[model samples]
Target chain A: DVKVTQSSRYLVKRTGEKVFLECVQDMDHENMFWYRQDPGLGLRLIYFSYDVKMKEKGDIPEGYSVSREKKERFSLILESASTNQTSMYLCASSPSKSTEAFFGQGTRLTVV
Target chain B: DQQVKQNSPSLSVQEGRISILNCDYTNSMFDYFLWYKKYPAEGPTFLISISSIKDKNEDGRFTVFLNKSAKHLSLHIVPSQPGDSAVYFCAAIGNTGFQKLVFGTGTRLLVSP
Candidate 1:
């Protein structure tokens, strides 16, 4: 079975603090993604990496950045945490474009 | 704008009834579509999927129907159990270089026993 693991399941950070959320996939998938879930807004993509050192901005990439220095790991960074950035963050990895992606247990973030 | 849209925010059904969740997409380029189920404080899990070339795909009690002309799709769950209650999100991929999944504002389904 494929496993996508998030570094933390829950996080609390103060406003203006830099936050990092890490994810690792054991399947060595080539594509990795970061998304934030908010009520009534659904899962908005923050960023995605197709390969090591390659990144693309998604629909909601503002206030967020991502890193993919290796094949199995992807990281999401909040430039400066804000109250509005509090939400559930999810990471996913897919081996190919036409296949289903496996998701990690989300990390619930609270910014105060 | 939301490329994928789930108009119904919530739906309720009895245990033995059929639960239908609808989704529509505005992007004609999308060729692959998927449904995901998510519980509270959990990540979304892939449920079922349908390609544009096929009109219907079934896996046990869960069936996905796609209407390419209408740019619409629906998931039908028969004999829904309480365990099936969860937020259902519809996602689409256009195969534009890399797969960038566009998701709809999920529909929360509640199955009563």
Candidate 2:
């Protein structure tokens, strides 16, 4: 079975603070993604990395950044956390573009 | 503009009955469709998928049907169980290998005993 693990299951941050969400996959998948899920907006992609040091912006990449220094780890960075940024963040990994993806237990973030 | 749409936000069905979930897309470029089931506080899990060339695909009690002309797809679960209750998301991917999928606002399905 494939295992995708997130650094934090829940997080609390203050406005204007920097926040980081980490994800690691044991399957050594080539593609990793970061998504933020809101109540009515669904899961919108924030960023994705196809390979180490290669990143691409998704539909909703504003105020967020990503790092993929290694194949097994991907990190999401919130430049300046705000109340509106509070939501559940999910990380997923896929071995190939056309294959099924495995996801980690999401991190529920609260910005006050 | 929500290229993919799941208009029904929620649905309820009795256990042992069939649960049908619908999804529609406006983008003609989308050639691959997938369904994912998500539980509260957990990431969505891959359920079923169908390609544009095929009209239907089945796995166990779950079946997926696609209508290319109407740009619609549906997921059917036979004999729905309490454990089947969850939020279902519909996603579409273009022909590109990058696999950037456009997802629809999910529908929450509840199975009653």
For candidate 1, state the interface root-mean-square deviation in angstroms to 1 decimal. 1.2
Expressed as tens digits, the lDDT of each residue in A1-112 for candidate 1 is 9999999999999999999999999997999999999999999999998999999999889999999999999999999999999999999999865468899999999999
Encode model 2's per-residue lDDT on A1-104: one tens digit a residue.
Answer: 99999999999999999999999999989999998999778889999999999999999999999999999999999999999999999999988755577889
User: Listing every candidate in turn, what is its Cα RMSD in Å to the true structure after a full C-alpha superposition?
Assistant: 0.8, 0.9
Pairs in clash, predicted candidate 1: none
lDDT of 2 at A100: 74
Tens digits of per-residue lDDT for model 1, B32-97: 999999999888999999988899999999999999999999999998999999999999999676
* Docking quality tier of model 2: medium
Per-prediction DockQ comes to 0.78, 0.72
Model 2: per-residue Cα lDDT over B15-70, one tens digit each: 99999999999999889999999999998999999999999999999999999999
Deviation from native of the Cα of residue B90 in model 1, angstroms: 0.6
lDDT of each: 0.94, 0.93
Backbone clashes in model 2, listed as residue pairs: none
